[model samples]
Structures are given as structure tokens and as C-alpha cells.
Target: MGEMRAAVLFLWIQCTSGWMHPKCQIYDSGEDLGHFLKWTCNYLPRHAEHYTAACEDVTAIEEDLLGLPPNINTFCISMANGQNRSMSLGFFSQFQDLEYLYIDGCFTQILPTGNIHLPNLQHMYLIVKWGMGSGCCNCHIGPHTFRNLVNLCDLTIQGYRLTAMAPDVFHGMTQLQRFIISEPCVEDLSEILCRIMNIKSLIELKIKAPEIQTLNQSNCSILNTKESMKPVFNNLASADFSFGEIPHIEEGALAWLQNLTGLSGAFSQEVLLRLPLSGIQQIQYFSCSGSNEIDIERICNVVFLLSIKKIHLANANMRSLSMSSVELCTGLEYMYLGGLGSIHPSPHLKWNFITSLKNLNRLNIDFLRDKNPEICSFQKQPITWLTKLTLLINIQILFAKQFSCLVTLQYLDLTQNLISNIEDFAFMGLTNLESLDITQNKITQINANTFFGLHSLTWLDLRNNPLIHNIEAMSFTHLTSLKQVFLGQVNNPLTEPVIKLNLTLIFGGILSQLTHLYISSAMRPKGYMGQRVQAG
Candidate 1:
């Protein structure tokens, strides 16, 4: 009887010491005795469906994964040390219903070659860290690596030093749509495109290669010639080629890609002129920066053919920008002419060219330089003739009753300028202005009629300024439709303490409609008698 009693005590200790069967559906190898016992006692009785395991050695938890419920659809494994690890073939073959599998920070040189059938898996991301050694140069892909994943739509293979891939590496992925290769060590662009052109359903392709210099005809002849045996990229809609230097694309290089709507890269004028203009008439979005010389005449000659709608020129020499030259491309709706600290347009000629763009919806002209502001000057000029435009930036100051013709202006950004004072009725005709950003300026105070006619304004950003002391009671009275206001960091704290604002007198009746308000902690007033403000 004494021996029997000792056996019962041993069984009691085993049950209380946090040792449960693997079939309990929640296995945490990293948990200590106390925490494991608490979880088993509190959470295990409800029959938790999900299972999670954290192991110092990932290989030891491979058997425990098979004991999970068969209906488990999501599985994630994170390795503690990712120096040299290998995933076993057919390791995940049991969980056929799994839909998502994410393996992060696992160092694998090559994927195992075997039929690891996952018929229902839809998404998979394998992010491995290639070790710093000579063994990384031997990394490659074997055939039939992902042969069983028939339903997989998105596949991303990143952080690998792949030297070569077999011809049939992606042979079975017929339904794949999007493939992204970012920051890879691959050199040849034509070799990669030749392998993936068989994917007929691909719509978007983006390659961010920082090491590549040129993409001339020799490397891109696959797209130029028509092959009856191989398929072309007929369904490709958008392509972004962001190499370091200006890639020299030869004539008829991208002529067969009829559905390509957007193309972004830096190219020279001579190379751009060599392209088949009649073949790329459907391309509406083009963003090209000059690498050799900023020839405005060459830019006009190229833009006149494709009928571009939106163009962004960076580091461009706009000295030849004239009314007759800009009128060639009459279909432009949005234009961003930046890095123009040296090209100053005459006020009369600039106004004529701007008014001629009848369909223009947005225009951004930046002239902020390192020197003391002598490039573009419009300190006290009469602003007129922009009835259809909706957005403007960094043109000049907005005097009272000067912008009465710009009735359609809704969004305006005049940040980082040399405007110190805004006279009364400065924004007199901007009745439909919804959002305005005037931060990083030298404006000191606000008067009663500063924003007199902005009735439809909802969002206002007035931070990072010297408006610390004076703000009249009716300064924002006309902005009854204001919903959000950002007034944080309005004073230079290095020179003075935070300024206290009278919320009752500043917002008045408009405070009831404000849904979001941002203010500094030190600027909160004491003994304030107003409604409780909502913080956004």
C-alpha cells in the first residue's frame, strides 16, 4: 500500500509539472514550466484550434508540426539563427489545406528537388539570408522546384544570390500573375525576361536593379524579334526599369509591347529619338530624366509624338521652354517642372503658355535653391488666367483679390518660401479650397480677414512657423467646413517656451465641427472653459 501511494504522488507531480501530450494542439518549446502550466490549465480546456511553437532549433519542431489539426491553413516558422539551414523535402506535404506559409530568415542555398505537393496553397514567401562566404556563389535553382504548387498565384523569392536557374524552373506555374525581383545580384536582364515571357497572364513587372548600367539592343533582342515558338509580353501593362545609369534602349526594342502603358527610366535624347514613335502611341504615362544634356528641344520633339498626358522632368534645362514649344504637346493634364533654379521665365510668356494648357488640372513649379532667392521672382505680381487648374505650388505670394480668377483651385502647397506677412483677403477667391499646406514658412500672425473666402476648406496645416503670439478671434471664422487642423510645433521651442492658445476664442463656433486637432503638450492652456477637444 505504501508503494501504491508513492506511484499516485508521482502521477500527480507529472500532471502539475507542465508536461502535456503533443496532441494538445498548442506546443510552445520556448515556454518555461510555470507559464506552460498556466496556459495548459487556463487555455487548453477550451480546445484551442490554432497552434504555435517557438524553438531554438527549428529541426526539432518538425515532427510537432504534423501533430497539428488538419484544418490549419496558416503556418509561420521563424529561425533563431539563420546561418546554414535546409528545409526537408515534403516537409509540408501533410498540410494540404494550408493557404499561407511564411518562412523568414532561413539560410538555404538551394531548394530541395522533390514533389512537395501543396494543392491548395495560394501564397508563399521565402526570405533567406545568404551567408558571407564563397559557398554563396554556388547558389542556383533546380528544375521542378515548385511543380506541385498549381494554385499558387503570388510567389516572391528575395535575398538570394542566385547564379543560374534551369530553363524549366518556372515551367508549371501557369496561373502566376505578379512576380517582383528586388535588389537581386543578377546582371543580365534579357536572360531573365526570356525565361519569364512564357507567363501570358502577367500584367505588371518591376525590377529595381541598382548595379545595372545599360539595357541596349544586344541585351534586349528577345523583345524586338518575333518568335513563333516563344510567347511575347502581350498582357504587360506597366513596366519600371530603375537602373543606375541611363539605359540605351535601341530602336524597335519595345515596339512589340503594345499594351505597355507606363514606362519609367532615364534615357538620352538620341536614344529616345531612335525609338519607333508610331508603335508607342498608346503609352500615356512617361517619366524620363536626362543623363547627358538637358535638351528642351529634343524633349519637345519626343513628347510631340507619343501624346503624353503626364510628364515629370528632373534636373532639366528649361531655358528653351517657350510658348510655341510647349504647345506641341497639347494633351498634357499634369506637369511637374522641378530643379529649375536657373531658368527664369518671363512673366508674360509664362502666363501665356500656362493659359494655353486648357486641360491642365495640376501644375507644380519649384524654385527653392541654396542661394539667397534670385532665380524666380513673383513677390507682388498679379496672378490671373488659371480657371481649370486645381493645384499650384511655390509660384509666389497670394495677394488680396489677385487670385479671383482661379475659382477651381482646391489644393495649394506653398511650403518653404519667403512670405512673412499675409494681408487681409489674401485668399479672397479660393472658395472651393479644401486642403492647404503652408508649413515651413515665415508667416508671423493671422488677422480676422486672412482666410476670408475659404468656405469649403476642411483640412489646414499651419505648423512649423513663427505664429506663436498673435491669432485674432475671427482668423478662421470663414472656415466653417474645417474638420481637421494641425497646429503642433508652431513656435520655435529653442528660442521660447510653448505658446498657450485660447481655444474658445480661436475656433469659436467652428470648434463644434472639428473632428481632429493636434497641439503641443506644453501649449495646453490652464482653466480653459470650452468643449473637450478630440485628438487625432
Candidate 2:
């Protein structure tokens, strides 16, 4: 009993000593300290030696931030109601151990003074929300304001109404690797891009200045120019620019980056029309999004360096794909094309490009309306390599032998296709298919042979249909590996009010592997609206 009392006394002494520091005070009672500024500081979890501080709703900026922990490593300040104070200062140097800093609020100026410096800081985020305090500009950051941050590696500055920024604002950041900027009012982006030319250690760079109307050779010439004895950027691997519908991009403007591999952004037709002739190469993954109708035949005449492995086009109208368009990119493994408003139909080409690819694994084409009858036969060639496929076209019928060539397919989705009938042997050769989704269609019945050859199917979804009013016996006997099924009805006022299917008859087959079943909008004789069953 004496030893236990001694141990308890020792722990109490340690706790008291730790909290006795001037910076580690506790203020959980919300008592006013008689000061206009309100802030708090505490030790971070698992980092008993470090502290984080935050101040919110600040209305003023003084020369020094007093009454807070002086050695904090992380600091965040939000001045949503700032009074647009401008004073030349070096106030942030007090946090000698500061590593991360975040500043957010609406103001006319942020860090406009050049005296601020934090040599130990590695990351900084500055967000200036849209405001009309001055009604002239949201925020105006000065040049060379952060030249003293020698150890800064990652920096992000996002403001839509930034009007003034010096060309040499990013001068002393030698170790900078990732830089992101989303200033839309800066029309002359070349000035900013020129400042980062000397950052040889940069790996990822992204800019979204939509107001820049043109991207020409002169705007990007400094990137290829030599500073000391060699090119400025030697380690840049990824660069994406979203310069909102620029009408022109001079050839060779972006071809200088020899080590770049991944590129993504939105470009105009004038740029994509000249991409093949732009001389840019070495890109392996490319993703583009736009609303313009792009002539894909011209861009796919010759493979871009023949090193492309994935091409994702989101909302870009890529019209009429031919075998030669995709066959040239021999290393492609995944292709995703989707657009909701694209109306140009592809001339139903025999999708030989799919079977010709030995490395292709996934293909998704969504919302590209094709009213052609031949578009239903996706696998005209013998396709035994693709593992996943998705088609959301307006196909009305699943004819016999339609998917017979997809013997190795594992996952298939044909949702919202208006399919009304599935002939016998429609899925005969899909022996390895594991998951199937046919939701939001017009399928009215489930024949015995509708899923005859999907012996390995595990999950089936048939929700939001007109109504499954008929079911031939043994409709699910062939799905030996089935585990989950979704059967939901989409109410139609024109259809007669009646309970179409009996649950016992649908589950009469040998469904020993079934574990979960979902049924919605089901009008049962017992008045149960929806039912969900879980089995062993």
C-alpha cells in the first residue's frame, strides 16, 4: 500500500509540471481573457512535444501575434471579417519550430510585405475567398514575399480575383516540389511560369488560370532556355494546365519536358487538332475533359510516343473510333470514354481494336447515345482477354450470341439501356462472369435460358424495371455461384395494380449459395411493400 501511494504521487507531479508551462494553458470553461483576439493551443495526439494553434474570425492584424504558444509547429488563422490591414512586418518568425501554416479569409491583401520569413517551414496554404470588401480585387499578394522560406517544399495559393503578383515571387524556394495555383484573373501566366523555371527539383505542377486566352511558343520559350549550363527543370514529371478554351497553342510549346509522364486538363479544339504535330512525346497517361466535339480520327493518326497506357476522355466528344485510331497505341491497357451531351453516333465498326489489344483489361463507354442497330454486337471479334466491360447505350434487345465471344468477362454493366427482351443463349459464352447489372430497363420477364451460361455469376441486379410479371421455372438454377440479387419495381401508373411474382417460386431452384436478397416496390398479398431476406 505504501508503494502504490508513492507511484500515484509521482504521476501527479509529472502532470502538473507539464501543464505549468506558459504556452500550455487550458481554457475549456470559455472564460473571457479581456482580449479582443480569441485563440487556443494544445499538444497534438501522439506528439507530446509538439503543439498546434488556431485562431478564427479575426478582425485585425497586428505586428505580432501575442498570448499564444511561441514554439508551435503548426498554425492556422481564419480572418473572415478582416479589416484589410496593411503593415510591413516580420511577425511570423516567432514560431521558430513552425513546419506547416494555413491562412484563410477574405481580404484585399495577404502577405504583401516582404519582411516575413520562416526558414523551417515546409508547407504553406493560403486561400483568399471571394469578397467585395474593396470591390476592386479579392486579394493581391506581393512579389518576393516568401523568398526567405528556403526549406519550403509544397505551396498552394488559390484565389480567383488575384490581380497583381510580381514575376520573381517564387525566387528562393529551391526545394519546392509540388506547386498549385488557381488564380483566374492573371491573364499573363507566362510571368509566373517563368519564375518557377529555376526550380529544378519540381515534380508536379498544376495551374488553372482560365482567363489566359492564348498559349503560344513565346509564353513557354523560357522553359526550354538554359539558365546556367543546362535546362532549368530536369525533374518535372507531371504538368497540367487548364487554360479555358484557348484558341491556339503553338507547336512545341510543351514538348520540351523530356521526363513528363502524366498529363491532364481541358483544352480547346485548336490545341487538340495540332496535338499530333505538336512534337510532345513521352506521356504515358493522358486525361482530358471538355465540351467540344473533337475529331478523334485526326488526333489518333499516329500514337503519341507509342507509350500511352491509359486514355480517359471525360465529357469530350470523341466521335467515330476506328481500329486504326486505337491500334496505333499498342500499349493501352484501359480506355474510358464518357459524355452526356454528345449526339454524334459512331459508325458501328466491328470492335476489333478490343480483341487486338493483348494488354487491355477494362473498357467503359457511357452516355454516348448510339441509335444504330449494329451497336448491340460489341464483341463481333473473339474477345477472351477483357475482364470488365460497361455499355450504357440505347440497346433495346440482347440478341442470341451477342456476348458469346466474351468467355473471360468478369464484370458487366448494361444499365438504363431500354432493353426489353433477352433471347435464348443471350449470355451463353459468359461462363466466367461474376457480376451483372441490368437496372432501369424494360425487362418484363426472366426466362429459364436468359442467364443459361452464367454458371459462375455471383451478384445480379434487376432493379427499376417496368415489372417482372412473369418468371419461367428454374430461372436461377444455372446461377450456381449466385449470392446476392436485387429486384426492385419502378411503379408505372399505366400498368395494372397486381402482385406479379411469388417469392417462393423465384427461390424454388437450388440456390444453396444465396445469402442476401433485396426486393422493393413489391405489392404482396399480405400488404408488405418492400422485403429483404438474409439467408445462411
Candidate 3:
């Protein structure tokens, strides 16, 4: 029968070139459209998820000029400029149901040749282009290059001058669980910490390779073994070399990751005043930053580890942080110290070490270069399991019960704090505050008990106050669960000067649970705001 008419003309050219129909018919010529590779191919009117193929002057990559769509499962190959060829992803083995894979720019090598089996590869990114050819140290990693991605699970590798890699280049990823390497002139990390310490299903590990200056005792001697030795990262919990400049880290180079519990790096006040507190006594989320002046009582006796609970110190200038130095941590529950420089305002901030943190819940104190006036007293800091408070402190005034001990504050950020005055019951015992951000302040007027006892306030941000020119029409009538408001201004509309907000007598009866009302068509809105649209 003439071979059944050649199998019905090969299924009619695989259903109109869609290779058996997964919805595909896009051959775009979008982008610049000049020096070759300027491409595009978007199609999804019934299946096919994710397929980029962005190109521009790319030197080599030819899978029939990327006629993608084999049931695409996320695949992006963006490139701009190329040379040191050796590319050969074996045409991705015809996208056998591929799974997330992104490759960007200037590659000098990436040869997953031959039988490139991908068994549903799971997440893989490779971003190059750092000082070009031979600068990212010839960007090569071909020891079986990802050995047929046997279920690879999350693997990122950004090059900024890579070096010392190739320990069988992640042999046959046994389901690697999150492994990131953002190189910054990769300066030897002892063969990448002895090849991901034999990745025992690695669970989160970030390495920023900042010139890897040092980690003493002669390159972490295989993490100073012994103690029965069996610790191949039994599901490594979290490790971030904190973008190394490695001041010093000897004492058992990270106490054999005994189930390490989240730890960041870059600490140098002489390494937290001689840190080695048994190598982070079972750390429990500890981030650190440095630039000097950090003696917060010897880093609170070395990270007050009783399985500490979250403490992120930034830039480290921490002036006079005394209250017996964080009153023995008390299993802190999230605390971020700050610094942007200019500090000399510690007038009084002894909220009795947060009333001995009975499990304090979230508190960020950023001193955006404190420009003077600083006194935030809470008498007996009533952290009733505080919910979330961010203060960019410089403070001008918020007197009357300034945050009445945050009666369960649920998110409050005093952005760019220079507040001009929010006295009368200033949020008196916040009846469960639900998001309030006093953006860029120096307020001029919005009184009517200035949001007294915010009855479960629901989002309000007085944006960039170019000295608000009065707004007291029952100033948000006890915000009956107000729903979104951001009176915007100040980004130099010619040095700002415009105010006419009368949203029906300032949301007369809470304006029917107002659903988002952002101002700033040069702050103009005098009444009638029925169905959105009140000014430019």
C-alpha cells in the first residue's frame, strides 16, 4: 500500500511542525534583527511552558537555529557575544521533556556530548561573561560535564573569573538540592570544599568566592576530620561563606557541619573578637556584616548561642549597644542591627534589652546615617510577641504612648524616620496594627488624634512627605480596617508644593473599605473618588 502512503506523510509533518502538537507555531524575527542570532519564538495557546532562546551575535549554537517546542519545560539560552567555542550541549538530546535549564553568555566551554540523557533534569543555570576568554579562567568544566544530569536538583554557577573547579565537575548529581556558586575571582576554595563535601543530597550551600584569602590551618584540612568521621553533610542545613575576605577561621574550620543551622559570614572585628566559640555552637540563623567598630560586648559573648534564634548584624558600627550587651540574648527571635555611618546619637534606647526577649518577634533598627535626634524609649518594652517593626531611626516625635509597647504590632515601618510629630495616642496600643509605613518623613499635619488606636489598620503609607500641608478631616477616622493608602509626593516636583486631598471628607465612613488609593498627581484629590481615578 506504498508503506501506507509513507505513514500518512509522516503524520502530516508532525502536525504542522509542532512535532506532534503541543501548540507550537512561532518563528519570530523580533529583536535587533541584524548580526545573526537576533531571535524569538513565543507560542502558548494550549500548553508548552517556558522557552526563551534569546540570541544576539552568538557565535555557535545550532539546533537547526532553535526551532524549539518539543513540549518545552523551561529552557532559556540567552547569549550576547561569543568566541572561545566548544559548545555542544548535544542538541539537548531533543528536549526529552527537559526540566528548567538556563545558559547565559560568553562561554569558553560546555560540552555535554554524546548520549546526553537528562532524565527530567531539575534546575540548572550557568551564567558566564566575566572578563571574557580565559579570564573566567577558560570557563571549562568538562569532567563528564554534569554526568547526564541524573535528576539534578538546583545548581547555579555564575562566573566572574572562575578558577579551581573540576572535581569531576559534580560527577552524577545524585539529586543535588540547591548548590550555588557566584564566583568573584574564584581564589581556590580547596577544590570547592573538597567537592561539596561529597554532596549528601546537599541542602542549601552558597559560596561567593571573594578571593578566598584564607580559612587557616592549611586550607581547612578536609574540615579537620575525626570524631568518628561520618559527617558527609548529612543533609547540610545551610552554609554561606559570607562572601569571603576570610579574616581567620581556624578552630576546626566550621565544627564539621554537624547539621549546621543556617550561618552567614564576613565578620571581622578581628573575627568577632577571636571567634571560635566551639565553631558556632549549633548556630540558629546568624548573619554578619563588617567594617569595624563591633564590640557589642564581645559579640554578645560569642553569639549568645543556646541554639541562638536569628541575629543579623550589618555594616557593624554598633555604637554603645549596652543593656548588659543584649541582656544575654535569651533565644532572640529575629533582630537586625544597622549602620549607614554618621552615628553619635545614642541618647537613650534601652528598652531593657527588649524586656529580656521572651521570644521577641522581628525588629529591624536601621539608623540610616542618623542625623541627630534619637531617643526611642518604651519604658518596659512590651514585646507582646512583637509582630514586626522596622525603624530607620532619626526620630523627631511620636510622643503619646509612642507605639504603646506594640500591642502585637503587625508590620510597621517608619521609613526614612525624621517624623515631625505624631503625638496624641500615636498609635496607642495598636489594636493589631496591620501595615503602616511613614515613608520619608518630616510630616506637617494629619491630625485628628493622628491615627489613634489604629483599629486593625490596614496598610497606610504617607509617602515622601514634602511637608504634607494639613489633612485632618477626622484623619482617617480610626481607620476602620482601612484598605491601602499612600499619599505620595516629594521626588522633586519642583521642590514639592501641592496638597488638595478631600477624598470625600477624608474617607468619611472609611470609604467603603477603600481598596487602594495612592495619591500624587501632584497630590490632588478633592472629594468624589467613587470608582478610582482622582487625579493625574
Q: What is the TM-score of each candidate against the true structure?
A: 0.72, 0.69, 0.35
Which pairs in model 2 have colliding backbones? none
Residue 169, candidate 3: alpha-carbon lDDT: 58
lDDT of each residue in 151-252, candidate 1, tens digit only: 777666655544455645666676677666554565555655665666776767766655555554323344343433333677776765455554555454
* Full ranking by TM-score: 1, 2, 3
Each candidate: what lDDT? Answer: 0.56, 0.62, 0.63
Which sections of candidate 1 miss by over 4 Å? 1-83, 102-108, 126-138, 159-163, 217-231, 275-281, 290-293, 340-352, 367-397, 401-403, 490-500, 522-536
How well does candidate 2 score on lDDT at residue 89?
28
For every candidate, C-alpha RMSD to the true structure in Å = 9.0, 9.5, 17.1
Instruction: State model 1's lDDT.
Output: 0.56
Off by over 4 Å in 3: 1-88, 92-100, 103-111, 114-166, 170-191, 194-205, 208-249, 252-296, 300-349, 352-447, 451-502, 507-536
Candidate 2 at residue 310, lDDT? 78
